[model samples]
Target: MEKVLFKIAKQWIAGDTVDDALIAAKSAYSLRRHAIINKLGEYHTSKKQIKVVLEEYQKIVNSFRKWKIRGAISIKPTQIGLSISQKECNRNFEKIIQKARNAHVFVWLDMESSEHTDETIEIYHTFFSKYERLGIALQANLKRTDNDLNDLIGMGAKIRLVKGAYREKANIAFKTKKDVDNNFIKLMKILFKKGNEFAIASHDTKIIQKAQSLSKKYPRKFEFQFLKGIREEFKSDLVKKKFVVSEYIPYGVNWLPYSIRRIKERKRNILLLGSSLIQSHRV
Candidate 1:
């Protein structure tokens, strides 16, 4: 049953190995779409587990250089033991960052829930001066993101702007979709004015259209980013319009939990899984 569910989940996950992720990324590259590869796992408790995760990322960096793949890597803070100790997490991050820097591949620090925001930012700041290829993601839905963006912009940081995914309290996040969208645009405009480079990571047509319109006015280098398998047609359309685009591809044995969280965040994903199961049964 797990294997069956995994088959349905593959619409979102690339596969269970680094090789699977590379294959998916290469396919995207052929279509002029870049990728952000993430190994699926987070909130590990033990140092041993964290070390294993670090080694997997090291292998991924090596593969990126070996294949000359046009993409970067994204990692969650907890996956590397940020919850265990900030200092330990920093040590783990440095190892991966050094490998990425040596291979000339970019590393993106993925923002988790609101709780880890400050520490994640601190970690990013610690290495920002040392590695120009490192970037961090920001959750636009957070009430504090505007100030965070301002601070990052002052440092000329590259950011990947995303709508907050993890569930958070009403006091800390914008509850409605409209508010999140408005804040995202607001932050995006600020980035265009002051940020060095950033990614507009959203699938909303209205948001993408707003960014497209803003491009005419602000005219900064930015790319559109979408999750794998969610909006292929729209992504291709963006490519046709000559906008840079990238797919966020995740793969690993931990896909089940990741897929569950995604489904909880967006209930429509349940329908997507149901459709996948039906199609597979027919096949």
Candidate 2:
């Protein structure tokens, strides 16, 4: 059973090395889609492990320059040092930003569960002031996101809107798919109206269509982001239409949790997986 599962997981996860990730990014470039590479471990309690992850990320930053790929890296705060102390996390993150700035690569902060939301946003605010190429992901499932989106837009912060994957209390997050989708649409409307240089990161066909319609109306600077291997055909179609698309490619040895989360995030994800498998063969 584990082997079978890993087979499917491989379709989503790039591989367990920096070179594997670079190959994935190169593939994205060949498809005429941008790449957002991520190393898939997080919530580190050990400073040693965190330091290793941070250094790995710096290597990824430099590697991006060496490969000359128009790509970015998405990092979880906890993976750096957020699980230890905010001061440590801030120090480590600043190191990454400085290196990334020199390499001319973009950095994205991946929002974790609700417990880390405030600190993550604080980190984004602190760094975004110094780094214009930084962006942060905002979860639409959270009730507070409406206000948060407004505030981030006012700060001219680049944002990536996602229907969040983490589970939370009903009071904290919308529990039903309909409610979540509705909130996602509402937040996306706000992005089109007020935000600039943002990303609509969703694999839902309806949500992608809605973003297309909103772009026609508001004409904001934005791009569509889909997970690598999940919607190859759809992404190609959008690329053919001249829409900017990015593939979020995650690579690491810690692939099980991320793979399971992709399936368990919502019931529709299972259906989407099947659709992707079929569409992938066609593509």
For residues 1-283, could you state the per-residue lDDT of candidate 1 as single tens digits? 7787676678878988889999999888988999899999989988898888899888888887567678899999999989889988998899999999888888999999999999999999999899998889999889999999999989989999998778989999998878988999999888877878999988777888988998888888899998877766678889999999999999998888787667666565566456545654665
Q: Which candidate is the best by TM-score?
A: 2
Cα lDDT tens digits for candidate 2, 1-283: 7797788788888999989999999989988999999999988889889888888888989987678788999999999999999998999999999999999898999999999999999999999999999999999999999999999999999999999999899989999889999999999999999997899999888999999988889998899999888877789899998999999999999998888888888777667777787877875
Cα error, candidate 2, residue 204 (Å): 0.8
Candidates in order have lDDT scores of: 0.87, 0.91
Error of 2 at 74 (Å): 0.3
Scored by Cα lDDT, where does model 2 land? Answer: 0.91
Give TM-scores for every candidate, taking all chains together and pairing residue i with residue i. Answer: 0.92, 0.97
Q: Which 10 consecutive residues of model 1 have the lowest summed lDDT?
A: 272-281
**Model 1: clashing residue pairs?**
none
